[model samples]
Structures are given as structure tokens and as C-alpha cells.
Target chain A: MDPVFMGQVLVRLLPPLGLTMLVSLTALAIATPLGLALGALRAELSDKHPASRIIDAWVFFVRGTPILIQIFAIYFLLPKLGLQPPLFVMGVGALVLNSAGYQIEIGRAAVQSVPRGQWEAAAALGFDRHATLREFILPQAARRMVGPVMNELSQLIKASSVLSVITLFELHKAAEAISSANLRFSEVIVVEGFLYFVFIFGISLIASALERRLSAAGALAGAGSFAR
Target chain B: MTLLAARGLVKRFGSFTALDGVDLDLNRGERLVICGPSGSGKSTLIRCINRLEEPDAGTVVVEGIPTTDRQALRRKVGMVFQQFNLFPNLTARENIAVAPRKLLGLSRAEADARAEALLARVQLAGHADKLPSGLSGGQQQRVAIARALAMEPVLMLFDEPTSALDPEMIREVLDVMVELGQGGMSMIVVTHEMGFARRAADRIAFMDQGRIVAMAPPQQFFDAPPHPRLVRFLDNILGH
Candidate 1:
């Protein structure tokens, strides 16, 4: 309730903000391209394809489990498998794998949402499948993907809090330390919550701005008539 | 010279036979119109020729080569769809220029120049920068035609190109096709527009139940009519 105390908690939260961003952005940076490739493969390949089946299994497993369990499993289980990565790497790996699963679905849905006529047109124009996907299909799909991708990024940022259990000091862990020490649980929690809001709301703003910019080019205009 | 040949083309969709042991040949500089009732496989035949649909039986040869290399075959053959299928994200000019730029390795300037010329050819010179959505159905179809023509394809396939257009817009697209036909581009058009068939096609073929029942020069096709099915089709379409 006290303005001074809240301001102090906000400053304490600042240092961990960079760590939170680093983990989220790094995971996002690695997961995005990986997810896009998997997503495109999932969308383009038949459900009967072996690769598609594998991707389907991965998506199913990821969606079915909790992020907290995923984080815990990676943290606790990887050492048993003789992979002793640093705590930061472990946290990032978990985030990337977790986000990549969702990203793949997002990518698949976006790519699949493109009208089939576009594919036919690309084929008729003498483009190989790779060129068709890269040139014609992805550009249109990318526009539709912006919102979901940013949403995933926002979720990943918040999810980074789970890394606290793994001893990676991100935003939430920083807040826990401050609140535990000061015993001003309500004040510290409010400031921490506010920080999370500002971060996510900022991303949402960027997302809508991006959506507007992409749509301004008329990519989505008359999209309904894309198929016959 | 024969520009395209399809022999014993058979395509089955599960229990349905879309094309049943069909055969066709098109000479260079020829414009052939194919018309039939719905589900008669006219579109399937053309789609098979371009390798868009693989036939369960038979081979399509173009310029004396079998269509084993699909990308190469498609390079030589262009197709326009009933729906315009213009890339929604690309402007008309980019839509026309993309294939040449990507497939043929044309420079941007070269492709743009070629696209500009095509835009002019299609009577859409000023609309080059407009996206497909900004263009009318007719204009979009025109852009689609220009996009097809940009490949400098030796033969073109039209699958009911104007069937999706408004009544007033149909002629604009048909006019482009007529002009293209006059320019000596070989084409196989599948449409119900008998007037276009009469105007632009050197030969007209009537199909029913997945077979070509009659084929002749437009005058002979309309005047004498070899088959009873053709007679009924003509009467049904032209009787109005």
C-alpha cells in the first residue's frame, strides 16, 4: 500500500527483468525458426508421414503436460541422462522446447490457413514445392501468425517464472526473495504483478501494431476469395 | 506440330471416374475449347495435362516429351483457374513477375519490365501496384492471366476462368483470352461460354460422362453436331 515500499520493490524487480528477458528472447529466438520449420513440415506433410507423426506426438505430449512439470523434468531428469548443462542453459532449453511445441502448432495452423488455391497457383507458375512455400505461402501465413507468435512470446516471458524453482533468478524469483525478506507480501506481489502486466501489455501493443502494418498492405483483404 | 498430347488418360476419385480413358491432342497455335456438363471431367483432363492432377493411367506428352519432370512441364504450360488465385499479399505486378524472377532467374528490373508490358497487354497497365483484393473479379482474373503469360508458356490451360466472374466482368476476361488466342498462343479452355468458344476456339470438343463425345471446328461443331449429347448440350446452353 505504501508508495515508497512499492517503488522499492519495483527497483528490486528491475535487475531480474533483464534475466527474464534474456531467457525469453533466447528461447524465442531459437524456438521460432525451429517451430516454423516443424510447423511447415507438419502442415505440408500428410498425417500419415512418419515425420508428421513424430511432430504430432511431440505437440500432443507438450500440450498434454504442464509447463511446471516440463521445467521440473528438464531440471531434474537431464542430469540423470549425463547432460549436465548449467542452470541457465537448462532453463532456456526447457523454455525453448516448451514454446517450440506451441510455436509449431501456431505455424502449422497459419500455414494451413492459407488457401489451397495459392498452392495451385504457385505450382502452375513453375515453382518447386520449396519455392512455393518460401515465396507464396509463408508470406501470407506470416501475417496471420504475428498475433499468435507474439502471444506465445508473452506467455514464454511469464513462464520464465517457473525457472525460479530451477534456481535461475528471473523476475518472479527476485520478487519472492524481496517479499520473503521484507514480509510485505502484498506490496511486493502487487509490484511484481504490475511489472508482468507492463511487459505483456507492451508486447500485445507491439503485436497489434504489427498486425495493422501487415494488414495495411492488403494481405488479408479479399482473402475470403482466395479459394474456389 | 502437336504441342500437347494426352493418351488414355484415366483418373478415378475413389468410386467416381473423373476421366475415363480420354485422349486429346493440340497443335501449335491452336485454341481448343472443351465444354461438358458438370462432373464430365473436362477440368480434370486439363489439370492432368499440366500435372496438377496425376492420372491413374496414361501419359501426357508436350512438344514430343513425356511429362515426367513436373516442374519443367509446368514451366512450359501455364494455367488460369476459375478463381483468380492471385497471391493476396502481392500486387498485380509482383504476382506477374514472381515466377520469372524466381524460376527463370530474371533480374528485378527485367521482371518488372516484363510485368509492366504484360500489365499493359492485359489492359491493366495502371493497376499494376494494386493487390488482388483491390481489383475487381475481372481485373483479378486479368492479373491471373498476366501472371500465367509471364512465364512465356508455350501452352496455357484455362479451367473456367470466367465462370467465377460477374456477368459484366466476364467479357473483359474473355476479351483478353480472345486477344491471346489471336496472338497464336496455344490454349485449351474449359468453359460453358459457348460464345467465347465460338469466337476464340479453332476446335470445339463436347464431353459427357468423362469422354469427349464430339470434336470439330467451331462451325462444324455448332452446325452439324456429330453426337446427340452435343446436340442436347448446345440446345440447353444456346436455347436461351
Candidate 2:
């Protein structure tokens, strides 16, 4: 439990923070637009809109199955199918699918939470479907989704630890290597835990600030009838 | 010329019928008030005209265009709602400008200028930059009216616009509606305000059980209602 040894582990872990962020943020970047598209399509779901079945199935398959097996399928099985993506791409691919599955639900709830009157108003004003959703609905929904989506991003950050199974040396992989090599399991693990906490705590802080700004920007009617 | 005409309109919710073979017509620059008890389908009829609620049967023609042509129809007709469904993310000005810019291809400055003029018409000139959430209920409803008017719609539909406002606030929204009605804009309003009907409505239609049972000038209808349901409804609305 030497202080110098802990400091060395810290330095080692710090470099991989970039790699960890690279994976999670890239996965998030891919997932967000995909999730928003799926969520928008699903929001209009009804018996008449049969395409939602495909979206529903995709969401179910990704959410119902385990992420570990998904990574394994992409890394191991996909090579047999003549689609051997690099290990980093494989890890990112798996994380994006998993993150987007949850994000679909988050985005759908946020979009639907906008009052029905907004859609009606948009329609009455001659906004086409795309303009209605893009200009009117999505802006409001995006504000509501900010906090929940940040929480989802934090979850993705933690979930990136699972990527080590595919040999991608992200934060947790770096910590495992440092701890086992130095025989400082407790110290390295605790420090690694602290690092993860910092990432999530940072995101939580951003989410709260954004929420406050949004509430102030859209403060309910002077009489406060817009409480919801 | 007719501004709007709905013929044989029918709407149903599962087993219950909301609108049953109803027919309505609006002349250009006319103001018609639709009054009914809950579930009488007055709101449904207005919604169908804008295609907000698709009718199970029949056609709504606005300015000779069928409701099936939703974009064309909507461009000609605007609607205000009970809940004042103003976009929460945009300022009052943006809410009024967005549709014009996106749909009508107005430049930002043009749209903003139009929004300012419309806000002034609705008595919301100073609150242009404020969000609808920060406006009072009456102010929000007035902003809703301005947002609809921003489309330059040939006709307007109001579905209980003041039903959600406080008693004191109701007067402000009603004043805006009265002003718009006198400005020669064609409008169909669903309301229980007998005073608004008497003052602003050229014709009053009383509905019950998904049917328009009576249509007459407000003075004639209020003076001696033709139907027992209308009499009872008037008594209930005017009693207190």
C-alpha cells in the first residue's frame, strides 16, 4: 500500500480515462440520434402504424437480451459471418445498441409527455409532420429528456466497463491490470470506484444545472397553471 | 362563399358515438357558437373540421378544400384549445413565428414582425419574449389566439378556450375573442358563455347526444329555446 505505488496506478488509470470516455461518448453519440428516431416513430405507434412492430421488436430484443452476450456475438460470431469489425468497434457497437434501447423508452416518454394540445396546435398552424415533430415537439421534449438522458449516459459510462471482456482496456480494465500487477487490490479498486463516481457525479451536476435553467426559462404561467 | 362546411360528420370512441351524422356550415366572416353539455360532440365537430379528430364518416371542406388535404386545410384554419397548448420551449414570439417561418416560408424578421403585430392585437405586446408558462391563464389563451392567427388562417376554431381560465381571467380571453369576431374573421367557437354567444356569435347551435338539435340567432334561441335539452342546459349555465 505504498503512496508512490498508488500514485503510479492513478497515473496509469488516468490515461485510460480518455479511452474510457472515447468509448462511452462515441457510443452515446451514435445512440442518441438512433434512439430519437426510434422514439419518434414509436410515439406515433398505433394499430394503424404497423411499422412500430419492427421498432418494438428491435427494442425488445436489445433490452431483453444481455449486453455481454451481445458483445460476444459481435466479437466472436460476426467474424464467422465475414464481418469482423475491430475490437474497439465491436465494443462500441454493443454499447450503442444497449444504450439506445433504454434511450428509446426515455425519449418516447419525453416526447409523449408534451401536451396533446401542442400537437393539435402545431397541426392547426399547418406544420407538417416533420416540422411539427422537429420544430415544436422535439425542442420541448429534448428539454424534458436532458436529465434522464444524462442519467442514461452515466449508465453507459459504467457499462463501458463491460467492454473489458472483449479486450478493450478502458478504465476498469486499466484498474484490474494495475491492482493485480501491484497486489494492491483494495487501494486500486477503491480508487477506480472513486474515478467512476467522479464521471457520474459530473454528469449529474450538469443535468441538475440544465434542469434549473430549463425550468427558469419556461417558468409556468404567471399564475403558475403550467405546473406540469 | 362558405368558409367551412362539415357534412355527415361522425365520430365514435369505441362503443360510444361522439358525433353522429352532424352537418354544419360557416359563411365567410361569420361567427358561430356551438353550445352543448359534456359528451354532446360540439368539440368533436370543430376538431373534425381541422382533422384533429378524423371523423368516422363524412367530409369537412374548408374554403372548397377537403379535410383530406390536411396541410391545405390546416393552412386555412387555425384552432385554439382549452388547455392553451402553447409550445413550452419557445417564447411567445417564437411560438407565433415558428409556423409562419417553417410552413409559410416567412423570413425570421418577417415572422417576428407579424408576431409582434398579432401579439398587439391580442393585447400581449409586452410579453412577446416571455414563455407561455410565465403568462397568466388569460394571457396564455390570448397568446394561443395570436399563435393561431400567425398562420393568417381564413377561419379559426376555438374549443372551450376559456373553460380552463379563472372567472376574472375569462373576461380578458373573451375580450380578445370578441375583438377577433368583430374584425370580420370567420370563427366557430365551442363555449358555454351565453354572453359571448349573444354578443359575438351570429348563430348559436345547441347540441345533445351527438346531434345539433337547434340552430338560431342567439337572441331567438335564448329568448325561447326550441328544445327541452336546450332549455335545461341554458338554465344550468345561466342559473348561477
True contacts kept of each: 0.76, 0.75
Q: Can you write out model 2's per-residue Cα lDDT over A1-228, one digit (the tens) per residue?
A: 567777777788997878888888899999988887688778968835777777777689888888887778778888899997787898899998888988888888888998887778888888777778776677778777888888888889998998988889899988988878867798898778888898778878887887787666553321122211
Model 2, residue A68: distance off in Å is 2.7
Stretches of candidate 1 off by over 4 Å are A218-228, B64-66
Give the alpha carbon lDDT tens digit for every residue of A14-127 in model 1.
989888888888999999889977998899999999999999998997899999999999988999999999988998999988999999999999999999999999999888
What TM-score fits each model?
A: 0.95, 0.91
TM-score of 2: 0.91
Whole-model lDDT, model 2: 0.85
- Overall lDDT per candidate, in order of appearance: 0.90, 0.85
DockQ of 1: 0.51
Write candidate 1's Cα lDDT for B193-212 as tens digits: 99998888999989999999
Question: What lDDT score is found at residue B11 in candidate 1?
Answer: 96
For residues B63-157, write the lDDT of model 2, one tens digit per residue: 76665678888887889999998887678888888778777888889989999999998988899988776899999999999988988889999
lDDT of 1 at B164: 97
